[model samples]
Target: MRPKQLNFPLNPDYGTGATIRRVSLRAQSHRVDAHLLDNFHEMRCSIVHDCSIVTAITGESVRIPTTACPAAVHQLQSLVGLPISTPIRDFYAGGIARHHCTHLLDLAVMAIGHAPRPSTEILYEAEVPDELELPVPMTIWRNGRLVCRWLVRQGAILEPLELRGRPLGTGFAAWASLVFEQDQLEAATILARTWLIAIGRRYRPSQAAGRPARDNPEMLGRCYAYSTGPVETAVMTGEKEAHLHRLQREA
Candidate 1:
């Protein structure tokens, strides 16, 4: 089936925070004439347009809607210095990829106990290595309120090296809220882990059916690499839950 077009417009006023005005889709001429599936089902098989944009906005710095494809979502991952999944080849081309990816991250984070915080007073923080630079602007939010911002300063020193023997650029600055109670932190951690696991299961070449044999190597590599790091750390550390829950009750 030919792909469709989905458009999501971001509010021009960055001051009121980023807002999604609407999401609309259009089918290809050939596909328009063909019988179509429901929106939910069609999304599963179709190429979603601009899917990476949503993932890019939500994964690291922003907590927005989570609905994007795994590969496109991975491409949105600023930490990984890979190209965005090729539009034509990726499952869910267009916005569908992004929407699926966002949902995966959101689901994973929620699974860990990182519920949305109620206040914007908390400080959001993340630690990054001095390499594998972030190309996009980093946004900081507290209880859903935008607070501060930073961009990955290029020319920074590289410390960590990938398996490829290439020096990792400066690591990415993660987005979280400063006003989050301890429970919220725990929840967020859990949610992030869950999201990763979900993405890994759904998109990993080893798990997905119908993928070509030649495609296996790269997909496997990407899945393995994307699943590592902070999310893993969050999963390993069970301490955050109790502490966060207590903090939430007190709040």
Candidate 2:
């Protein structure tokens, strides 16, 4: 049997009448599992009011106002937690809503360096699963070197990173907020390194042991640079860009 469809309000001000019907038209067409449809329907209902109705000629169409959508509100809330200066809040919000994950990371990097030209040099190697991985699991790399790694998993015993500093747990949330809110690569890199150092001091990992040589700050800036220095340089020098452009032309 086909599962019942759901609907949600377009504008909350319409009381109960402003909802738009959202049928499981796509799921029905695909023959997806009934349980999945039901779960989806339930989730939609919880997020907003559903209003599905039947019409004689058209059958059914969900009526929603299009003004009071949850998407805008959700996006607004996400931006609220960021530490952007008031003047650029809207700009950052729009960027976040429209950007892909990689682009967002790029923005963070640029923000850190206060670079005027947007940079897309940093590439994300993989998506690290937050819950399954270690609290302080490595999540980001620039070039071939590690830029940031997880240092503390939530719910784990708290460790002290510095001799007289607070527990590592105390700073995790703030650090995470700064990271996610970054609008440029340089900023993200700096934040990532800071997070790593905090983790290293707390956990005393061999990876975090030494300071970098003076000639190569990128190579030895921190543990991550040692592994990712060459990669970062290659990207910065336009070699990576040229190679990518060549591949695209060939394709």
Mark the 10 consecutive residues where model 1 has the least summed lDDT: 237-246
**TM-score (C-alpha) between model 1 and the true structure:** 0.22
Q: After superposition, how far is residue 151 of candidate 2 from its true place, in Å?
A: 2.8
Question: Scored by CA lDDT, what does every candidate get?
Answer: 0.24, 0.24
Question: In candidate 2, residue 212 scores what lDDT?
Answer: 22
Largest TM-score belongs to which candidate?
2
On the 0 to 100 scale, the lDDT of residue 52 in model 2 is: 21
Superposed Cα deviation of residue 183, candidate 2 (Å): 10
Residues 182-237, candidate 2, lDDT per residue (tens digit)? 43333333333333222111211122222222223332322211233322432111
Give per-residue CA lDDT, model 1, range 25-143, as digits (tens). Answer: 22332111111111111111112123222121222212211121223334434312222232212322332333334333332222112112221222222111121224323333333
Q: Each model's RMSD to truth, in Å?
A: 20.5, 25.0
